[model samples]
Target: MASDLVELDRRAVLTTMATAELVTLDDLSRPTPCAGWTVGDLLAHMAAQHRGFAASARGDGADLAHWHVRPPCPHTPAEYAESADDVLTAFAVPDVLERTFALPEFGPEVTVRGEQAVGFHLVDYVVHGWDLARALGVDYALDPDAADPVLRIAEMVPDGPDRDAPNSPFARALPVDDGSAPLDRILRLLGRSPTWPDRPDR
Candidate 1:
C-alpha cells in the first residue's frame, strides 16, 4: 500500500462528495476556506474541475471551451457526486496515465506529465475535502493510508514567488510551523489556514 496515489485520490474525492451531501441548502451560502467562494461556489468549482480534468484525460485539455466553470445554476448534491465519479472513471481508462495533459489554465505551453497531473488533482481534492468539512462544521479525517502519498504530492508543488503571479492556481504559500500535523502542513503549503473560520478577527 505504499504510495497508491490513484486510490488515495479516489477515496478522498468520494468521501468529500459524501460529506458535501450533508450540506443543507442554507449551508450552501456559508463561507469556505477559499477566499471568495462559498460552499456552493466550492461545489460548483469542484464539479467544473472534475469535468475539466476528465476532458484532459481524453486529450482535450487544450480546448479552452472545456475549461470554463459552468454558469451558476441550481444543482443537487447527487450531481456533484456524479461529477467526481466522472473524473475517476476517466482516469481509470486503460493507458490514461501515459497521456500528457495540456493545462491551458496554467499557460498554453504548460503541459503536465500524466502522473503529475493526477497528483495535482489528488492534492486538490484532499484540501478541498477539508475545506468542505470545515465549512460545514464537520470533522474531516483523511484516511490513514493517505498521509505519506498525499505528503509526497504536496511537496512536489513548489512554493515561493512562483505562486504569487496574478491568476496563479495557488495562493502564495503560508508559513507553517515545524512539526505541524500532516494535514496542517498540507493546508499551509497550499496557502489555507487550518483554522480558517477561527482566524483572529481583523
Candidate 2:
C-alpha cells in the first residue's frame, strides 16, 4: 500500500534539516555544493520552498510572488524547523494530494498533478539534504522507506543537454559507480558530487 509520499518525504526532509539547523552564524558563510548558494542562502531558499509549497498545496501556486528565493535567512534553527513543520502540516490536509500543482517556476505553461509535484519536491529535498550534509561535514542517512520512493522518482529525471540550462530543475545526471546506495544514486542523478568538500571532519 502507498503511504503518504509527501509525509514520508517530509519526515526525511526534517531529519536533514535538523542537521542544517546546527549551522552556526559562521557556517552561514560557508559555500554549499549547490553552485553559488551559501549555507545561509540554502536555508533561506529551503524556507521559501517550504512556504511556497505549502501555499501551492492550498492552490496558491499560480502566484509567482510567493516563490521568490530571498536573501540569506534571518531565521534561527528553530524557525527553520518550524518551516518544515508548516509544510508537513500543509501536505497532511485532507485531499491535498488529490489536487494539481501549478508550478510556474518550472514552466509557466505546465502543471502537475499533486503526487507528481510531491515527487518533484521529494527528490529535490533528498539531494538538497545531501548537499547540506556534505557542507556541514556530517553523514546523512535517510530511512530506507524514504530513500526508496525517492529513487523511483529520481530516475524519471532526464539526462543530458536540457539539464545544462541555468534554470534546469536538475543538472545532467552525474555518472555513478555501480551498486551505489539508493540515496547516493539519487544524489548522482540530481548531479551532486557525493564526496563533496572532502573535509577531514566528514
Candidate 3:
C-alpha cells in the first residue's frame, strides 16, 4: 500500500509538473486563488520546495537556513520540470523508505519514520501541485487513491497554532458546504477560497 501510494504521488507530481511547464510568464503573473502569491511566485515556491524535499530525501538535514531561490535559468520552465524529476528520483530511490528524516516544522529536531515522511511529502506535493494548476488555469486531477490518504492526513492537522500561525500558508477555518466534495472541503478548510477569482471553465 505504501508503494502504491508513492507511485500515485509520483504520477501526480509528474502531471502537475508538466502542467506547470506549459504555463507562460504572462500566465504566471496573473492573480491566483492563493491570496497574495501570484502564479510566478507560486511556481518559484514549489520549485524550491521540490529541491528542498529532494535534499531531505538524501539525508540532508532540515535546516534550510541557507536555501535561497535560484533565479530562473536559461529555460526557466524546463528548470522547474527538472526539479520535479529530481524529487521523483529522490523519492523512488531504493530503501529510501527505510530511513529516518528530520522535519523541522513538525518539531525542532524530531525524526519521522520512512513511511510517514514519504506520506508527508506525498500530501504536500500533491496538494500544492493542485494549487499551482488551479492558479495557472491548467487542468489538474489527483489519483483518487492518492488523494484519499492525503485528505485523511489533512483532516488530522488540527486548526491550531501550526495552522493558524501568523505566517502560516493556510488560512483560518472557513465554512464548508455539506455537499462539497472531500477535496474541495479540505481545500476550503485550509483557507483556499472556493469562489475566488472565477471558477475554471473546464
How does each model score on lDDT? 0.80, 0.75, 0.70
Candidate 1 structure quality by residue, lDDT tens digits, 1-202: 3236667778889889889789878888998887777888888878878888888999888887676767777555666888898999988876666679878877877888777787788888998899889999999997778876677778778888877774344666788775988898888888788888987321
Candidate number with greatest lDDT: 1
- TM-scores of the models, in the given order? 0.89, 0.88, 0.84
Clashes (candidate 3) = 0
Judged by TM-score, which candidate is best? 1
Best first by TM-score, ranked: 1, 2, 3
**Model 3 over residues 1-202: C-alpha lDDT tens digits?**
6777668768878877777877886776776655676777667766776776677778884777413356754235666787788888988887777777767656668778667777877776666777777777676666777757877776765686676563355766567775877777667666676555575311
Better of 1 and 3 by lDDT: 1
Prediction 1 global C-alpha lDDT: 0.80
157-191: candidate 2 lDDT, tens digit per residue: 87888877764446667787659888778877887
* 172: Cα error in model 1, Å: 2.4
Between the candidate structures 2 and 3, which one is better when assessed by TM-score? 2
Off by over 4 Å in 1: 1-3, 160-169
